[model samples]
Target: MATPRIESHAFPRSWKDLIGHERIRSTLSSAIAKRRLGGSLLFVGPPGVGKTAAALLLAQTVLCRRQSAAEMNPCGQCPDCAQVRAATHPDLIQVSKPQDKSLIPLELLIGPVEARLQEGFCHDVHLRPMQGERKVAILHDADFLNEEGANCLLKTLEEPPANAVIILIGTSEQRQLPTIRSRCQTMRFTSPTGVEGRELLRQHIQRLTEAGQSPPSLADAELDEAIELAAGDLQVATRLASGQSNEIRGKLLTQLSASVPDPMIIARCINSHLDEISKKEAPLRRAGLRDLCSIAVQYYRGELREAARQGRYNGADARRLDRTLRVFREIDRSANLNALVDCYAADLSLAITGDRGSIG
Candidate 1:
């Protein structure tokens, strides 16, 4: 159980304070006034687009006992409101996909949730809020819920326990479970445009400077770098400002320029750059997956261009190009289900070290 959220200096107070996703906030706010709130809301959006934060706000709004119908928002001053804001409210159950691994098995969710349901929420967690009236569960990175995990969630969604509400946060529709999608009240968030993305990065830079942790004269140029790396994820951008150092652009360019001796060599060159990526498995693998997927798109685009050299493109080449385009279009797709990076490594090794294609 996380700590009850408060309006302390550490926490954000208003929906507008979030960097992106105004439409999402508006929908959630509107829902609060309706007689029947979405018991299960699926927040589908790019990471750092305020999904989880919105979930917390919704939890606060629903649990606030003294809020007026007009505002339909929590009085950040109330104890319940503060607790939920602090992430310490006992009834506010938060579940995240296992960060250590690529996927979350439904089994993990089943036992604990069932046990909690049987015990009537309080037994599973202690220090229930003295003020809040209901239970809220936030399932973050819900797209990683594998078959069993999603089924467990589906069961709960089908028959929600009294006074319990569930919010599922996912990156994209492709990542989400279809049945889960059908069941929940859906809300979608798009990546902020380049301009919005830059503004968000600037805000993070300002906040860090205001904190005195970073020097006031630090180059603001890195703000754009942070935005590009985050791909418009406000959370990622802020995290970068707080010290999550991403690879410098030059290194990535160097890696991409492997000895492209031939068709097979091109693949090997790619693998050579990524060889050590797998070694740093646990903590960095998630980022590795994102990078690998993005790189694959780049590789395919290059291949399609090469294929175009064969003035009359064949059907096979066109199909591969089409698949590549699909992957590019769905930036929010979870690469957890695929083994492309591993396969790329193997194929590249076969080309360079084995009998397949060769490159010096």
Candidate 2:
């Protein structure tokens, strides 16, 4: 196996440090406490949620040298806990997609599809732990597993190594191969909202402070603005803690509230701002588009509600709003940002003036 340098500087010290995911924490704690922990686990959830963090916590709990039968929590002070935290535990094998490639290569698991027991994560997992009682293999970015790579893991999943746990981290069960999903116990994570979201944000801010890092000075309203734009996403909320969210939200609101909104101008402004946010990366650009689309939807929904309150409801307004959402979905899936921008501009024009011919 690759014996790269490992450190716990990036991870939380204990499960309690993980924000939100109360149900996930309880279920995992019970499993650990009852000694009913399965050998294969699939953590499925949206981005920025604590799925990977939960998986790591489970590893820490299993490898903790100081816990008793009555306790399921990691002591965060034991040598084993420190090793696991630092990712230096000989029993723990963590694998993920290489930075340059999109998919987790089959070679990472097996030397070749035809090879029988060559060196790889699968082979390494089967070997007995060098230090701890149990081996824990954490495979991150499991969504990027190709058919061949995933199939190679089936045999091990079906008949796992004794005293070992294999945790696969993915965004959704649907994205994983059926065979892989069937062989593993699945846990779904949901993004926290409302009080939960706010609490999570507060905890993260506290962590930053504890780390001796100074975040941008933000007022209560500015903090709330970031949280509101984040829509219960902790990672997004944390990124917004730097005050970038306010700038983006302001631009979006200004465009929406323009007395005579020009679709071309609005689209250009949005694309320009998103380009800055994304730094020209296609994936980040798409994410920026999605965020802008969410803001636009909120604006249109408010307009529709206002019209209803005034007893001047227009079916066309609702229709345009729905179309804007559809366009957002399309933009998210499309690769050609330029073409998507044109389509988005046209759609926004339709919403603004009810004229499809306003922009080509």
lDDT of 2 by residue, 1-360 (tens): 333343464556777777777788788778767887768999987666777777777888888878852365789898888887777888888888775566787778886557756778889888987876888999988888989899989998988987889999987898899999999999888776656666666665655564567645566665566555555455556656654445667766776665445678777777887778876677677667766665666677778889889999766557556766666435433437777677666655566432344221
Local lDDT at 208 for model 1:
51
Write down the TM-score of every candidate. 0.67, 0.74
Over 1-360, each residue of candidate 1 has an lDDT whose tens digit, in order, gives: 222232344334666666567777666667556755646778888665657667777777777778852374567787777777767765677766544455664434654545634342223323333445567877776777777667656666766655667788887877787888888888887766556666655555565565546533334566555554555555555555444334432343343344332334434443444444554453354444344334444554555567678765444334433443343323233343234443434433233322223211
Query: Which candidate wins on TM-score?
Result: 2
Q: lDDT of all the models against the reference?
A: 0.56, 0.72
Q: Identify the runs in model 2 with alpha carbons over 4 angstroms from their true place.
A: 1-9, 112-117, 203-213, 217-228, 253-267, 274-360
**TM-score of candidate 1 on Cα atoms, chains taken together:** 0.67
Residue 356 local lDDT, model 1: 22
Residue 154's C-alpha lDDT in candidate 1?
67
Cα-based RMSD of candidate 2: 5.6
